[model samples]
Target: MSDPILKARGLNKRYGKVTAIDNCDFDLMPGEILAVIGDNGAGKSTLIKALSGAVQPDSGKIWLDGQEVAFASPNDARANGIETVYQTLAMSPALSITDNMFMGRELRKPGLMGKLFRTLDKKAMEDFAREKLAELGLMTIQNINQAVETLSGGQRQGVAVARAAAFGSRVIILDEPTAALGVKESRRVLELILDVRSRGIPIILISHNMPHVFEVADRIHIHRLGKRAAVIRPSDFSMSDAVAIMTGAMEPPASMAA
Candidate 1:
């Protein structure tokens, strides 16, 4: 079997007295959508935090592309080609679409204007942003320079996903991507997710929406009590079965245990 593109083992995290994650393990394969489902406070956030470099595990190891690595912050993860589109969307409402896409990692001009004066290459950044959005069919956005706040919720989500896809060379982790959208918008975001995966980058989707998970995920990772309970394919298990495994109503077979 091909090794997992992203993997975690023996991950543990605690908040002084409370354990957020305990001996947690995870795996994400190349070019596939891995849905992580868990109840509130089930340590799913903590696990994702560790992987994305938002939180450090008390003890554990993470690997990407077959090499072990550690991250001190989200920037570190981004440096290693791991990008996360948080639930909040994390964009500056007043900024233009191109600005939001290249927020922290803006491109600089080539000559002294860039090197000595630290000038930004706005055209380069805009061109790249426009290309990425067009590639993802988000050109429905009338203006590339429009403020993010002017767009609808689904359009904002599309911009965020497009940003991740543009720079997330290895993997993209999305948290509750469709939580706040109506059915139509949610469907668009789902299609965007599949489009990103179609480009060969694996995605780790953290969501509570079962139908969405069943629709896009190739394999579902069931998390419970701060650990992965089982990994099963939507093709082989019903949505109800995934819920049962997540809530401890049913025990997955030994083969499915993570």
Candidate 2:
């Protein structure tokens, strides 16, 4: 599409005798949801880890916005405007929604209090947090001050996604966001994914649910045998065909032959 906002080539990673990723190549177009799917132990996680800077690929090249770059850690990736939402959600159960939203990147009071005492700007953070949640259709909660533990699984997921949408200026990566959610909650999370994409930010999703992948992903990147086997549009590949390709039951489309 548009000169891929993120691109990788010949990515490889190994742990002792195990090869986690092998010669993997990937691309994410701007403002599109690119879903990466594979069976267990198929190196899907490793591929994402490498892309998100959670793990380093032994040999490869990464280009962000067409400039060759390297990430030494997850923080480095975040600094480069790439935010990842792990399945864990990474929220403090006892913290307020506003607190969780501004956990590491909290704002401070203006001028003296902010400079001398370094006090948190709770009002500002809460106001912005509410606005973000509202934009994502997650404003049903009666209190933003309530502990995150009191929120439903879907609500918690929404908060995490809201945080990402608020700050992930370049790209947002989600790993199995709906795996632990119920049918209705999962559906809500899917809608949130689309909402996030509509904001003009590209997304990279890693999911195992075939139905979810088919429903939300504009394009699918099939991972097999520790590498990318094919990249196909959802319109060109059925859910059954995608699964077959992941499990080696069917050959990839000839146009995508690598």
Give the best candidate by TM-score.
1
- Per residue, candidate 1 scores C-alpha lDDT tens digits across 1-258 of 689999999999999999999999999999999999998889999999999999999999999998999999999999999999999999999999999999999999999999999999999998999999999999888688999999999999999999999999999999999999999999999999999999999999999999999999999999999999999999999999999998999998789988
Against the true structure, whose lDDT is highest?
Answer: 1
Model 2: per-residue lDDT, tens digit, 146-236?
A: 9999999999999999998898999999999999999999999999999999889999999989899989899999999998889989998
- What is candidate 2's CA lDDT for residue 250? 95
- The TM-score of predicted model 2 comes to 0.97
Error of 1 at 240 (Å): 1.0
Error of 1 at 47 (Å): 0.7
What's the C-alpha lDDT at position 11 in model 1?
A: 98
Model 2 lDDT, residue 19, Cα: 97
Deviation in angstroms for 84 in model 1? Answer: 0.4
**How many residue pairs clash per model?**
0, 0
TM value for model 1: 0.98
